[model samples]
Target: MSGAAIALEGVARTFPGGAQAVRPCALVVPQGEILGLLGPSGCGKTTLLRLIAGLERPDPGGRVLFDGRDVTRLPVEARHVGMVFQSYALFPNMTVAGNVGYGLRVRGVRRAEIAARVEEVLALCDASALASRRVDQLSGGQRQRVALARAVAVRPRVLLLDEPLSALDAALRERLRDELATLLRRFAITAVFVTHDQAEALAIADRVAVMRAGRIVQADTPRALYAAPADAWVARFVGGAADLGGVVSDGSLLLPGGRLPAPGPHAPRARFLVRPGGLDLADRSEATLVGAVTRATFLGDRLRVEIDGAAEGALVVDAAPDAAAAPGARVGLRLRPGGLIVVPEAEEAP
Candidate 1:
């Protein structure tokens, strides 16, 4: 089945006692593309999904559309959208095949057709061999595969995944994450996946929408978001330990030790962001900082150095493990032009 187009216009949700769970949020998911809603806990990613599924009503004027047709008033069953929750949510007594076939049977599909469709999805998920096994007997990854197969067995126009990988072990989660991405693309299904994991969203989403306090702060390709965050909050959230602090003045970085040409455009009074990988130990007269290595850790191909004398926080630089400077040795640090992200200063930068 071809993918459906999804649009949310001014969708908002307000809980009782004056809690605005979701602001007026708008987004469009094109046919055959994956859009990820990424944020920390209590950011309303699940609430937004429930809104689109018709399980929760939008505040007064909000609307949800699928394929350019208003579906705000339609019930969940009428929308033909498939959902896979964090829990596999399979019936306890059902075998793998039975769980996968339940949805088809609900729609009144013929008995023979339900069997054929179940077999088809089982093969797609590489779980055909486990068709007769009970859900209780399946491993975590196997259960996830069965859940996904059940969602797609009815040829849904749109798919929604709510933290489906959060329950698995790290290795299984990674494997299933890749598998899910491939399956979505192969079926050409429009999908919205909600996750609190930065790596998971960056790895699987075609475009990621970073949410904060009930609103979308930024939406862009993963590389772009990491390389160029719109503000300090986004930079800190997406960049993790890579967030660097510096002041900008007259097209230069006024670092603690010295000055260097600012990497990007910035307000006269603005803070700068530099990724750890963007800073290197370079020999230059204009290098902004001179710090003594207080600690160093070998990280496979790279070394993480903790330096003192430049700023209050550690200056983490990536270098060849063998090239790491000796502890207590002084090193000059330089910021690469492409490494900096200039954010306008606000009491609280958006």
Candidate 2:
């Protein structure tokens, strides 16, 4: 099925007691694009999804549009959208085929057509072999497939997934993430999925919207977002980057150990952000910073070395497995070009 473009204009949500869950925000998802709403718990990612699905109404002057048509006031049934919750929500008494065919039946579609569509979606989701099994008898992965098949059986204009893979174990979730991405691409449906896992969001979505406190901090492709985060919070949240507290002086970041060249001219009090991969071991004569190795961990293909006295606190670095570094060993650190990012220091929360 073809996808539809979704647009939200000035959308906001508030609880009955006047607690605002979502601040007014505008967003757009192009047709056939899978946009990942990524954030921590209570960041309003799910609330934004519910607003799009018509499960929750927006505040006054907010509007939702699909394919340039207004759908702001439509109920879930009339919106023609598909949704998959984290729980799967499959009926215990239903067979796989029965669950897949439920939506078509609700629409009063002809039985023969419903059967054909059910077969097609089951095949698409690689669940054809499980058609005869009861919902209670299927595995977590199989159940997830059945849920997705049911959602798509109605040929929805848009698909919304709320942590669809969260119900499975870690190994199973990792394996199914690739499969889910392939299935979404095959269907070519406009989809929005909410996820707290940074790797999951980066792996599956064409674009990611990083939300915080009910606001979108940055929206960009996975590579761009990782390469250049919008701020210190985004750098830490998206890439686990370390914040190096320092002052900028003469185009260099003055740290406790030594100075590293800064990106561009900024205020003297600007803090800096650096990814773990940005620091590398170098000879003492050529090093930009110096610190003592506090810990070294073997992570299959690489070594993670933790250093002390680098900046305000300890800093971690991704190093080669063959590097001869150990705990309590002194090492010189070189900041690669484009490695140090100047970011505004986080404001103190009132």
Per lDDT, the best of the predicted structures is 2
Give lDDT per model, in order. 0.83, 0.90
Q: How many steric overlaps are in each model, in order?
A: 0, 0
195-301: candidate 2 lDDT, tens digit per residue = 99999999999999999888888899998889878788889898788988877777777889897888576754566888888889888788878889999999989
Q: Cα deviation in Å at residue 319, candidate 1?
A: 2.8
Deviating ranges (above 4 Å) for candidate 2: 266-270, 344-350
Q: What local lDDT score does residue 290 receive in model 2, on the 0 to 100 scale? A: 88
Output candidate 2 Cα RMSD.
1.8
- Candidate 1 lDDT trough over 10 residues, lowest sum: 239-248
TM-score list, all predictions: 0.91, 0.95
Candidate 1 per-residue C-alpha lDDT over 1-350 given as tens digits, one digit per residue, 9 for 90 to 100: 47689999999999987888889999988888898999999988889888877878889899999999999999988888888888878888899999999889899999999999999999998889989998899999898889889888988889888898998999888888888888877767888889999988998999999998888888998998887677788887886634346566677666676665774555666667666677788663556678788888888989888777665466677766787488998888887657666665555523
- Listed per candidate, the RMSD to the true structure in angstroms reads 2.4, 1.8
